[model samples]
Target: MTGNTHIVGGIAASLAFAQISNDNPVLLVGAGVIGALIPDICHGGSIIGRKFSIVSKVVTGVFGHRSFTHSLVFLFLIGALLHTLLTNDSIIAGILVGMVSHFILDMATKNGIKLLFPLKITVRFPITTRTGGAVENLVFAALSLLSVYFGYEAFAGYF
Candidate 1:
């Protein structure tokens, strides 16, 4: 999946979290965006990767794309680290959910993802689409719509 799709997924996930947890949407959405982009740090062409080229090179050199960073082990480790560093439940949830959304989107791709790292296992939906293909564009459109829906549901009270 593309970065725009990940971003939309993050926004949708964060907005959904806000509606469920009744927390600050701004912080959650911020963290969510970070989380969504963080997993793609292995790809130098990724949204966050371009900004952190050194880290991207190191991570890609060590683990390769869609291997360790896309794994559930990394997700849990990040969750733990974030929990230890930050006490806000909503923010943590936002980040984790965003990351999960990344996993979900990647899993839908033809290349799939190594959801379970250190195990050399790949997990994906039975029906997967090529990255940036028509199916992916459709997925992106759907996520965009979901983001709008979740945004309205979460922020309607403020409006």
Candidate 2:
């Protein structure tokens, strides 16, 4: 999926997290966006990868795109690391949800990810689309609007 779609998914996941958690919505959602893009860091053309080319290159060289980074092991380790480092459980939850959202979005693509890793099991939905294609764009738009609605609902009383 495109970065735009991943970002939307991330935001939506964070907002969803907010519905149950009392963390600062703004910080949680922001971290969600970052987490969503973190998986794609293995791709040289990814937004985060472009910003950190050396790290991206090294990761890609070692594991290749959509391999280790897209796996459950990576997600668990990252979540554990973040949880250990961050004091707020909500932030850790938001980031983990965001990263999971990324994985969910990628599962809708033709080239699925190795979710189990080491086992080489590629998981994908029967209904899939090309990356950045018309379907992906539609998904992105719908998710964007959903995120906005969720945000409004999340902070409705603030306004």
Candidate 3:
């Protein structure tokens, strides 16, 4: 999926989690938004990649696109690292959840994802959606709406 899709999905996932957890919704959503874009750092042309070119180049050179960086191990490692650095459990959990959502969305695409990197196992969900296609865009849009609604509910104490 594209960056926008990942972002919307991440925001939606974070919002949903926030509604359930009743923790700091802002922090969770922030971490989730960032986490969503974190996986695409392998592509130099991506928004996050272009913003952090050096990091993107290093990560792309080391793992390439949709390899180790896209794996669950990488997500866990990142979550742990962030937890250590930020010392915030909620943020760390949000990041992991957002990254997992991204990984799952990618798994539904035609290209799929190397979920078990180094093991050389490519997992596809059989749904077979095209990356950045109209359907994906629509899904993102709907997720965006859901995110907005959930965010408002969380902020307004409607839950």
TM-score of each: 0.95, 0.96, 0.91
Against the true structure, candidate 3 has what lDDT?
Answer: 0.86
Candidate achieving the largest lDDT: 2
Please provide, for model 1 over 1-159, each residue's C-alpha lDDT reduced to its tens digit, 9 standing for 90 to 100.
999999988988888888778678888888899899999999999999999999999999999999999998999999999989998877888899899989999999888999988888888999999888998888888888988888888778878
Candidate 2 per-residue lDDT over residues 1-159, each given as its tens digit: 999899999999899888888888888898899999999989989999999999999999999889899999999999889978999876787788889999999999999999998778889999999997999999998898989988998888688
State which candidate has the highest TM-score.
2
The runs of at least 3 residues in candidate 3 whose Cα sits more than 4 Å from the true structure, single-residue gaps closed, are none
- Residue range with the least summed lDDT across 10 consecutive positions in model 1: 15-24
Query: Roughly what TM-score does model 1 have, to 2 decimal places?
Result: 0.95
Worst 10 contiguous positions by lDDT, candidate 3: 150-159
Clashing pairs in 2: none
Which pairs clash (backbone N, Cα, C closer than 3 Å) in model 3? none
RMSD each, Å = 1.1, 1.0, 1.8
lDDT of each: 0.90, 0.91, 0.86
Residue 130 miss distance in model 1 (angstroms): 0.5
